[model samples]
Target: MKNTIAERILDFLKGFPPFDSLTHEQLLIISKQVKVSYFEKDSVVFGQQEALHDCFYVVKDGAIGIYRDHTLVDQCDEGDIFGLRAIIRKDQYLLNAIATEESIVYGIPAKLIEEVLNTNIKANRFIIASFATNTRNPYSDEDKGTLFANETVLQPNASSFTEVQSASFSKNPITCIPNTTIQDASLIMSSSKVGSIIIAEDNKPLGIITDKDLRNKIATGKHQITEHVEAIMSTPVITFPDTITVAEAQIAMLKHEISHLCITKDGTIHSELVGILSEHDIIVIHGNNPSVLIKEVKRASSAEQLKQIREKAQGLLQNYIEQHIPITFISNIISAINDAITKRCITLSIEELKQEPPTSFAWLAIGSQGRKEQLLLTDQDNALVYENVTDDTNTKSYFLKLSEAVNHKLSIVGFELCPAKMMASNPKWCLSVSEWKSQFKTWITHPDTDKIMLCTIFFDYDHVYGNHDLVDEMSDSIFDAIDSYEIFLNFLGKNALTNPPPLSFFRNFLVEDSGDHKDQFDIKARAMMPLVDAARLLILSHEIKDINNTIARYNKLSELEPQNSDLYNSCIQAFRILLRFRTQHGIKNNTSGRYIDIDSLSKSDRLKLKGCFKPIKDIQELVRVRFMLSQMM
Candidate 1:
């Protein structure tokens, strides 16, 4: 064991629990003796009724689920301590500790804990309290204060979380008399601060007029305001009962493409109008509307404001998936918000630079940002592509300065700079079109692991700002390079299959066996990315470009390979469901939805997850045959 790694692990542990109360020398001594262990999915660290080891474990990475009688009682993520209960009680383990995914953990000797307790009063009190809080009173602690806390521990009915939460409603709706003119309807709507007006007949909703109707019909001179409310109103309006949830309302509006839905006593025109549900009301609750969020992004001048807006967008994403809004639409809206954020970053960077960019350059968002499926806030993957500058030795320095500014501003706007320094500020990543072409040629021809990693990152580039022509030219060069080096696709195929779908005999999910996340599956690597990588490889083979989004690629594949349209369509559907599952898990845990504890999932959710695996297995089979990877496997 590296002393540095052991010291680092001790440093983390000393900040928390019983370890915190121990003397520095004592803690460091225990840390040095700690046994570092790793686990694959489903592997048991310690089973119920089994004698405890000399050491109790602390999760260093991933999760460890504690199960009693096959029911998960608690889950310990990063820095969470487990396995001490058995030692404390002087009995065999009452619950099983299983790795929730491939994870790293440190086993600190229980003897050291005893030594600290015997010598230090403070350490003893802390140890007793940790045991009381975590083991004896598990429910009253972590469960009560955290949002979505119910999801962390295993339970029944896990999948039945509200599909659409009840959105708060406006009790009073704007109304107009049947005889009211279109002009008057407009005035009432404006004064009432509403986007729609309900045309009521005998106190019952007869029709509705929205801003769109006035703009599309009256403003275009298709109709005059002098026309009565009935002339312009859309009769037999869509209505729902007051109990309609934000999810349902969003779906209704998107399905109809209308701005308003009447809320009546019985959800129909025959019933009395009780309230109004307008698109604005839904947008307020929906949280993720790109149009509304972009407006917020435009007005945001500070990092704090952008953070709040970004948080709201996360909720919006949750609602979008729950409502079954097509993934394509979801990706588009998210992409718009992401672009708006990047644009704001650019503006902020320029201000901080105290000067404008020296030359025209396109800001390219690579990887998930480029694919537009980035619902989660992750490290920024961006590059800069400037117009070729000739005869000026000073041009390189100017562009470099500009990239530094842009990268810094983007970091402030919530995109953490890539740790590998793949951002535009890295001169190697920020290249002119001709330079990028040569770089692509080198990577394609070489196709080593390092080059492949770069190819993966750069392949997903989507222009966030500046010249579209330059981006198109770069893409054209990429395809040309691929066409000339056919073996490069095989290299990609091998890389795609590197992490095979995590399924075992009888099609059960293969989770990590030991370490911190024992018995948990990595949904991202084992499921989602296989599909994503496969889609990328197949699309590249078809010589298709500019389609980075996974779902879009599948949609395009459906059109291109009519012979395999069924499988392609199935892939799209499966991808959508899996993406949603991963996003929900991520949101609930406040972490990337890569590692998933199988015990926490309800039977139905497990089945639903299993259903997604079918298509994955089928698709991988397709990839294997198409690429002749059977022998390679």
Candidate 2:
């Protein structure tokens, strides 16, 4: 009597996104409406330039290979949807969708989207984002040869964005004993179809034999094929840790003039080899270069023009999100773009003055920007520090005018003024190096509710431009102040615990009890800020100055306190999830991603978000207990 087939489909769809975000009732409607189609191996579901299907597909079983020409573009397994983008556009399929194996696909009616998008803005945004991220084809011939073929929807994909990403290396690296014959190594390489093989003894890498080694040594008759691998192997193999990044790997390759690198456990020759990274891996990941956007920002003469570029960078962000790029890597890419824009704004402001700086100074991005975790365009939180001058009044006046100019330009380029007047132009924040140092000391030595809050904001400052020494001096002064007033860290720790973690997203208990945006969750204040405050407090306690980003700070904390490594690591994961959620909401609503409507989240999203809450509660408790804040209260 039950609609078991539809119920089964509903169960499958509930585990995936977009649908997972829908209510059970809405999803059941969609499930019952879905038309099931089966295809044999290598069967075409839709062909390039073919008329659009009335419905888009979800793979019920097996795999779908989406091809543009003969090149495979994407692989869609179970839970992956295809043909939706074309249906959304009401256009012909631009790429061929073929069943790579015998598959059953569920085709959901296009009207389901109409029903969903009409009432659900969250679903609407997902559909829009998918359309924006998936396609690259021109709408018309006139659009070609411009900056992008489809300038309207084109955003940089994750592969093209700047790389601070961990290299996805060959984890099961091909290895041979040092005494193995060169011919035997070559045969092993041929069977595995890998370009390189490591020469190892007792799991420790001794050397590497790349294809070039064979080409240069054996082919040139410098070494015989029957000779031992060690005889011709490139000894002293360049070894790096498993945590090597794409940029680091690329630099290492160029620095040592070697293509293959052995990833070891301890980043030392004596450590056990864990993986291998080669130039090809880097090349495959390289796409829309973040450096290209940075260069564009530098060339812009006006803030208005820079604003256009910033809009384009959001496309990159969307693409990165759609591609499921690592959140930390995405943050790094966006922050780099933001920093470049700010630097350009300063340059333009300086040009407007028609006079050089009166003294050595450093412009800094504080708070979120300082941490380089500001993925969304939000209020500017910044400051300026100049070298101390005898004629402080005139010097302050000059810098005030400069800061105002810079802030105005920054505003035009999309970083709006902070409502709290926490910006360089505020004069309160624009101070000489000595004055800034004194301010830091005051905040530390004589801490209070207000000063502690200010400390949270200002302590995360990162130099954006101008003289570097001024920023370094300020940092050294902060450590000095903290050392002099050791209890200051406990104050900071207590402040970090003020915002308790959410109970979970299942109920309204943790959301705003009364607000204009009533019942909305303040993800920033409640979820993200707690983690940010904890990371900053913990790192500051350790006297580590270099790590400003919350993720990086937690990473450092993990290294410093291996005893509490799991807690710190969990915090890092939770922070990343929260930050990504905030950015996604910001993208959807076109506002600062600080607030979230608790009701709109999909079941999958709520559960994913709920999983992150436990870590927050644990970290906050750790902060409360470690600082022994009961006495302070």
Candidate 3:
């Protein structure tokens, strides 16, 4: 029988992949033969161009730095597989690996790994993923497709990676003579259905006439119809080279305060104009401009159009994430777009009803939208706050009809009906302002599971489409109620600490043990939601409002609590890494980023994840002491 250490190694190896497909007995046999090696900090494991070792390594402890031509390429730590590139390619080592810290590693014979792979299909896939991950382009790809490939696994999660690329612009541009009349330019624009006409001389763009130019310059009597194109055109057109990315194009438009960019062969007007890229062209190709999408939402009469637009927004989200754009900025942009769509839905619903709203009412985007941290399409959590009425039944009936239309429109626009029916259309949610304040008071005074659930969902409310005063009044009442009952914060803090971060008893990963999720890590409950929930609870305790995003809340906390600034700052850093990790994992596996298959991750990734647990551990300890909740559990 293999010793306990070998069996333990085999068990871990079996869960992770290429080894998972091997027979238990065979793996056990091989594990026993594995040689354990130790290296001091900065000690060279192998040098570039060195002949390959007989064995490749699995990191047991600490980190190893991989360098190509003396430039660091990657860091490998626990559970990481390294030195196998040489074995795989059957070439000399192309990178030098040195210990980043005192480290222990298990050296498995190259022959054994090959033997394991000979029969295991799953193991073979794992090997392919490992190679693909390490060699994937750093500039072009973000490790989005290297994890898993099953359709069932890929659909539920939303990611801020793996975006649909912007459509390539046409290179051959049509130009016009610089001295053409406004009349001729109008004819050209009519024939083209394009909003702008680029005026050029000798194939070089000189100026541009857009619909705006025609309206403001010609129609408004700033210039005559018989005038030269230059008289009615905006001079010195914005220009970019053919190599501009979709993102760069968008930025250029915003930066230079111009709509049409003359695509010049050399990116300067002195060069020949190859093509003209209009703002409308960008809107059609990219589908993400907030203003353009809002207009599309307004015109969309069908559900499918809204769905396609929403799906395109997901791609935009992925790009924002990859660019390392601030999550707050992403959330604001997405929420503004989402809010516009919702407002348009309300308008459509009112039109469908053939009756205006009977009284002033506010549509509240409760939960994540209220806190403004909504990054994924989870569900529609909302409510309604209406002006008080003498006849409750008549008011209720009027608003319920309006809400039903609004809710239906929202579903058509890609917001799935809230599973718990926590929606405006539900009578229980559509309440007068006084009633909502009473509800808040009750939840605060009598805290229980149901009350907690209600508080958790409702307290993070943002005014979606409503009377501003009603929302402000609601907010005032809520803070007043909380001020009267300070223990509400304690209750919230207790709830935050409920699901302690899932570090195992021995400080290893506590993976899901059975069922469909067996051998996978619960990233949501174990990692993400804990941080999110903790941030919400912490922010609420401080009586802060409208900061729902996890990382942003931590950043605010860092500023507010300067003495514990390091802790809050670490939380922010940890949350960013976790968010990025989840996004990359979700994009790769096409899953909801809630669970992670441990075997699919390389040893280095596992170590990086393990590093994230440090913040989770420290923060949870802080929560315990601050809340003084030793007796709660």
Candidate 4:
């Protein structure tokens, strides 16, 4: 009897690891015996001290949280495996595995994993590496040599350190000429057992056709198989020099979102094509550097490819956090990757429109991204400002369409759509420079509760892609409006004080009273936001521009006000610690990092967090005194 579900399981398992190391026959056999389980949100699969189940679990959908003493220790999302530690140890579970969201999971029998561990060295090493990374007691000498007694555990290479290695490519690349019939090219590809075939003239690459092109064009009947390959092939192919490193190659593929890159002698279209590099080749090289990811984003041809790369970046981020890399460094690198992806999406959208913009436009990243504190994938908050035009209808239409495309792509790449529809794709947010100026004026002058909220989100705008002059003009306009309505800063100050300090008089955390995160501390709203609000208000009052980052703003403030330098420095330190803490929590629980489980934190961590609150309290008082917000409050 045929089992369709088993086949699907095999397909999914093949894409992820320890399973990826297994043979097809082994996977098929294991998949057939796999048990599928469903779990509701907050439902526990196993509790700490319970006897280990007969099998380990792999997440098929949604997420599972591994908790120690009711505190989340790790989160297992799609394709992630958990519970193996307990199985390997043959002991009571040390952590509780609970569904963080409604989920489907596959349970692979312990016997199968044991067999794989004994038979496959790579599978064993991967499991060991995963345990080393995930386990809280990884450095415990008793567990180190015990798991892999005979086999040595090879740690995964640091991504940044792997960038300089030379890249490997397919030397005997399959090729055709411009005049080759699509059918002939297809036959050649089939005969050669290749997914792509390059079209060249004088041994210089002209275009390329891949399996995607065939599926999208020939299979869809958009183009006939009898047509010349040139009619369907993707032209002006991305070419890289043979001297490119593994990191460079990987980045190239990601940047263009293309699966294949043409390797040429001189790294130019004018040079002779020598070889071909595919995404598969880069994956095989195992270089997961940020530079490589940025390149991948640049070469990404579709949103889906960018999405895969972004997911890979999450893993990289987790590794960095675990390694205790500087939080500022991590933030800067991730922000650069995010900015690059946004820019590439914009570039791709323009190509899709097949026309130049009628006027200069600037894409503004607002909120966390604007402040350059985005360390994890979060909702996109952006707006667009274009040059004023006499007949604005056509220009607006063009930009709206462009924004729609860019926003959709950004969403696909892991940035969630703004729940409030604060994206540029929204017509209200996408406006000409003049309209944007007028809108800012209204919000500043009016300064109502809603308007102040909007001001907090929008005022920290950073130019992501497009005309800097336009963004500069927009900034200038904001200062001009604030100058006219000086009292607006008081309203901003009042809003900043709304959250108050995160700690009570007894130094207890202020947890949520109600909602999904009732018992959890709202880190963003209570801790991070107060600092963010203070920075924006203070910076704006000084009429500073081009300094959207919270840390940078505080640093600038410290420099400008030597008398208040201590408070500003304290604010900076608090903001940095909180930012890192939030990022680690997000990574641990696969969450937004807005809510923190107080039970999960160690005493030292709690003390550190508590210490940060004093700065928040001091900052609020300073704002009150500076802006005279007592009456407003």
Candidate 5:
């Protein structure tokens, strides 16, 4: 006789993880030994310090809350495994597992799992990875995802790996008046080849009808075929703006457990319907690759065209951030797009000049843009360095004219000119190589507050276009000057410690007391800049000129100082979190994302920001002791 219960369990197990890694016959055999248990909400499945059970548990239904000292750390939904970490190590449970909702759990016997782990290499790696994650960081477990694989890309709920852009939806949404018969709506859906149709009044969505509604209402005879759509439709249809992201649309669908989202002008039903976002639309996105955008930028005939491509890159970035792509990967992609745009701007400006330069020159992007960590469109900060010329007058004039044209084009393409006049067009900034070296000497040796600030901004110079040799010489000059006056590094370190991660005495975020963003948190100056400054100062001390990105600098620092690796690694995480926050806030508020409203932040965001404060505090302390800033203080 077939064990019907075992077969049912086998079917469910085959759809999910490690069990899925095992052969069908092996899974069926294991399923026969599975012990199903039920628990009530608020009841403990396993208590902290309890001896390990004969089997570890998998969540079959509802939610299980993992807690340490009664503080909820993680919530495991259906198909999530718990209690395995302790069982793998043959230790007592370190964290309590309690049911958050009435739950059904399956207990897979430890001996059987061990037998599978011993026999199947594929299943062994899969199960061991989950075990490794749980042992390393119980709080994260990398969320029990596969090592080095992008889960977001693999899942149907999100788009492809590189497809981090705004979601594309059908602008010509199929629709009908609310009073239209269900039969008419069905016919409209069929003719339109759409699964859903909006019930609208004057272009505003009142409700929606999908094929599922037709099957459940009409096929089940729950509602008559001639009844009005309002009687069979899903009322208060979910909505988003046309700018919704692929991941966001996927999440909304998953969260609401619906197939369609009504896209509105202002992202609400009260506004005019602009389009409809269906799951099919996101699943079919071929992905917006950065290389494609770069090729388009290279071919762009006008700054306006480049600007449009750049805006598309912003959508890509939004999707990346939403999908939790590695910050370093996102940085590389965005920087490439930005670099391509900058190169195109220069090319157009050069063509407009209709004359070649007097000598070899290098365009330098200073500060954030130079660092290649710029994720959002911001004001341009740049300079120019040309080889020493006997004809000083024409050389300076030619480069200045070129710079002016380039700056204007960049501005038109959405990079606003620096309000501080820190651009290549400025005569002070567009200097010969010798002049640039002299300028670096002046800033480094003088060591005044203003000079130090300028040094901080200009020291991270990167060759954006033209001669690389000129930029290399500039780097040599800065390092040579730093070697002569080591105190400058101390001063730089002192500057790095200026803002200590914006926290009040009571552990609340320190907010702006005045100005336009009164009561808002300055995420850039308070959180991001501290890490950026620390990385720069540390890298300069090591004479590492090539690495400018904060994340990359921290990675290098980790390699250089293994004892301090933990601190540097933490700084990388903190900086990435803060940078992502700034980008998100900027996109949402249409500002630079420097100042964020504390009231608007979710509890998770507030905690993430708070987590960054620790590394900021530690790095500052390291700077103080290493530089002896304590005496200066």
Candidate 6:
């Protein structure tokens, strides 16, 4: 069966996420099984509450308008996937899928999706994250102690283990040309507030002169102050690359009996001087315990300095995981370090802008960082919300420039730019308070697959900096929209069930079949997110706000539903175990803690993970029954 349509569908599917995570052979299978369908302009593909289509759809041409009731929720054009949440839940379509113009779509079978989910960890994760964003509900009423549960309950561990944390150095080193006079060099150092200056010729480090050189060589009349710096400088300077660690820095300084080390583009002395690491910097590294690291982050003058401190923090993280510290405690510490770095970057960016903001704004950390569940360094996901202004144009330009500066600095500090460009720097994500409210309202009221994806990301935002009132207002606006559109939670509830229990019908662990993590389990998608999504749906139903962490949300759920206390407790325990397990895997593999190699686990560990799946199944059943999801099915 040679099918050109399937080939076209495969070509289109390969370009999108979840699908892109699948294999060529797998996609070929899916594409061949796909049912091609067409719709005329303004024709309904599927109506709200219609029986679930056996397959989900991918738009091939024109656009599909997903609607809840009469309101258009989201518009999907080429390569966008829709109708999947319903098929996954085995439920009726929550929203109508209508063609905005003449269109072609490929309906992928639920069976194929199940096969892909079971065999592809990346695809599975993409599906789960797509469906279940912002599933943790923060507790309402500002009980600061409960709001940040770990800060209130967990005691900070005194770091007994000190590894070779990398040394932080100033990258924008002071420099002078070889012909520059000694007095001019001293003036350059004075103005730049550096203790040493490198003398370079053609961007290559030739020599170095320090305050000591002025004191020992020139001040003692070894050379005239007005002489060229090359006359007084130390030739054949010691150099190390930026990757040099604290121990290496210390040994280098001691071995050479030098007070400064030139950080060159390459490790060789012939390379260009990019930075100067001095005895003072080495001393700072020794002082950088976790608390000292926090202090350093606060006082960090540049993104590169913060990047070095963050690297040290990663060492701290590795040590903590090896020591088997509580996952909650580790997350709190890492999150605090991350937040401090973000705040510092924001502060530095503001200073760079050289102008006060036109209005109050709140910078938000969304997704994993918002839930404070980030264990490894991941891409930055953030948004900006400013107060309403008479003329939004100037205000938006100011904040956009501010965000551009902030996002750039964050990238420099090792928080990679988000691949999807969901950063505050993006014009779509940077909005005024009213505009944000409207944006949320549209998503909530319309409630489509695309809108749901946005909801998952935007809903879990935690304020990183700026005005608290703006964040609070945004929160209030979200609840208000959800209140008016109460059925939206049901749609979210169905979405939460998108990634069903991770176990196969035979009770074997479901692992990916191909790609980077072939044969590895995705603990994040299969085990963790089910609980996270359940918590958010349950909490939002109660209109509770502010509790973003999954464990904390479950704890609250236990109190809110005494009948379901045992289930919630089970979930809490499972979540904690899963979190620790993922953190350990991340440290072991030096990755983002998403995939798990099943063969690497012991028999007992395998059973423990399998046990976690039971609760996921149970909670999803609870959501189905609670929301009467079976009616849709």
Candidate RMSDs in Å, in order, are: 29.1, 26.2, 28.8, 25.5, 18.5, 29.6
Go through the candidates in order and give the clash count of each. 18, 3, 8, 17, 1, 8
Query: Rank order by lDDT, top first?
Result: 4, 2, 5, 6, 1, 3
* CA RMSD (A), model 3: 28.8
- Output the lDDT of residue 207, model 5: 94
Q: Which stretches of model 1 miss by more than 4 angstroms?
A: 1-167, 170-239, 242-289, 391-393, 514-516, 631-633
What lDDT would each prediction earn against the true structure? 0.75, 0.81, 0.72, 0.82, 0.81, 0.80
Best of the two (4, 5) by lDDT: 4
| Tens-digit lDDT string for candidate 4 (1-633) | 888999999999998877888899989999999999999999999997687789999999998976666644456778889887667655556578999899999999988887998888877656655432332222335334322212233243322212323557898889999989999999999999998999999999999999878987999999999899999999899998887665466445534656788999999988998999875565444435554466567768888878887887787778667756667667777787789889999999999999999999999899889988998888999999999999899999999999999999999888999999999999999999999889999999987889999989998888999889988888899999989988888888898899989987777899998998899999999999999999989998899999999999999999999999999999999998999999999988898888988998899999889888989999999999888888776
TM-scores of the models, in the given order? 0.58, 0.57, 0.57, 0.57, 0.61, 0.57
Error of 3 at 22 (Å): 77
| TM-score of candidate 3 versus the correct structure, residues matched by position | 0.57
Model 3 spans with C-alpha error above 4 angstroms: 1-287, 322-324, 514-516, 588-591
Clashing pairs in 2: 21-602, 160-287, 160-288
Clashes of 3: 8
Better of 1 and 4 by lDDT: 4
User: Cα miss at 188, model 2 (Å)?
Assistant: 52
The reply for model 6, stretches above 4 Å from the true place, is: 1-286
lDDT of 3 by residue, 494-520 (tens): 777777777778877888889998978
Best by lDDT: 4
Two-way TM-score contest, 4 vs 5, winner: 5
| Cα displacement (Å) at residue 368, model 2 | 0.4
